[model samples]
Target: MNKTILSLTGAVLFATGAVVAQTMAQSTSESTVAPQEADAASVARGAKAWTNHCSRCHNLRSPSELNAELWDVSVQHMRVRANLPGAVADDIKAFLMSSATSTGVQYSTPGQGGASVASFAHLSPGDPLHGKEIYSQTCIACHGADGKGTISGVPDLTAAKGRLTKTDEVVLTNIIKGYQSEGSLMAMPPMGGNPDLTEQDIADVLAYLRKEYDIAPGTE
Candidate 1:
């Protein structure tokens, strides 16, 4: 395991109390809707621009990875880091927030550039309600409704949470690109076999898993 990645991701999970409180306080129903309106052309234009510019530096994480406010912070920080123009950066930020519209459970993790939210800042306690839907769509086939595996070599989630030493980062990163466990023939396929799963979708599913299994928060 990469120690740096582990420590960084761990810190975000540990610091959620403050961010969540702040977000809920600031995000009133009226206040949220006004700033959240997306430009008619922002999504399409930003998506194209993101692929063209941002992908050059890092893996193209789905827009849902960071919340809009986090995205705003990241884009501004990156604008300076990457020397991006104001107009172009705004478009990129637009694309991100459109795809991953905030559900008000705001959590900020460390950024990719330094200790701020940037290219890699992700982890929302996530919406367990929405996560349940994603779980049914993607993970139900193999993991089942109760989180018990239906096949050989598959670990049951109820018990698997206790078995793994490194929970959140290890599991999440694997979901993105896929990986083989330390001693298993059954390699976890990328996106858990759902090719269309976005990073945000995966985050939701993880939130469900963490809640259902009582995994993430105090595990480490």
Candidate 2:
């Protein structure tokens, strides 16, 4: 009887240990996946809000232009003017802060104005196929499916003396730092309002724009 009791106790303890270990493993997996999913969702929502509301006022500032703390303060101040809901503003803040620190791109201060031609020399030639994908996802909203301007102030990519008439360096820098066209009410936001865009992505998009729109160097 004594032996049976001891055996029963040992089995129960072993079972409990197995159960606890499994629970911990499950928790670990969930904790890892949940934050990644939540962060992506938050970034996406913030990108949408930024493109829709913030672009209405002026150019979209580059994430590299500000520190996280400054972004927080700026967003809070703009929240009132943009009439963004508290939750939406928070999401936008999350996106800005995340992008500001996350991208490995070298940052220049806003006071410096913009990037120089030599600064972008390391950029690889763009791949049109991949550029098409980026254009579809992000640029399509304002640039339209046909490379024409969807919004009133957006320059037509197909026009002879339009946006792409400039050299690749000029276009790339403008895209990275953001640009407001002369006499236009709205400005193109930095990184095309998508913080996830990389230098390669911008290159690809430029290649696609040239190919699809038949862009040629126009007389300055």
Would you list the C-alpha lDDT of every candidate in the order shown? 0.60, 0.72
| Tens-digit per-residue lDDT, 1-220, candidate 1 | 6999999888887778668877776665557567643463554455456656775687655455677689888888888988888777877777666545423211322122222222325556567788798777556644667877644455677774342324455556655555445455444445654445677777777787788788654333
Q: Estimate each model's TM-score.
A: 0.42, 0.54
lDDT of 2 by residue, 102-174 (tens): 3424234222354454356777888999999888776776777887866567778888887788777777877
Q: After superposition, how far is residue 217 of candidate 2 from its true place, in Å?
A: 4.2
Worst 10 residues of 1 by lDDT: 105-114
lDDT of 2: 0.72
Model 1 residue runs over 4 Å out of place are 1-120, 160-165, 217-220
Q: What's the true lDDT of residue 112 in model 2?
A: 39
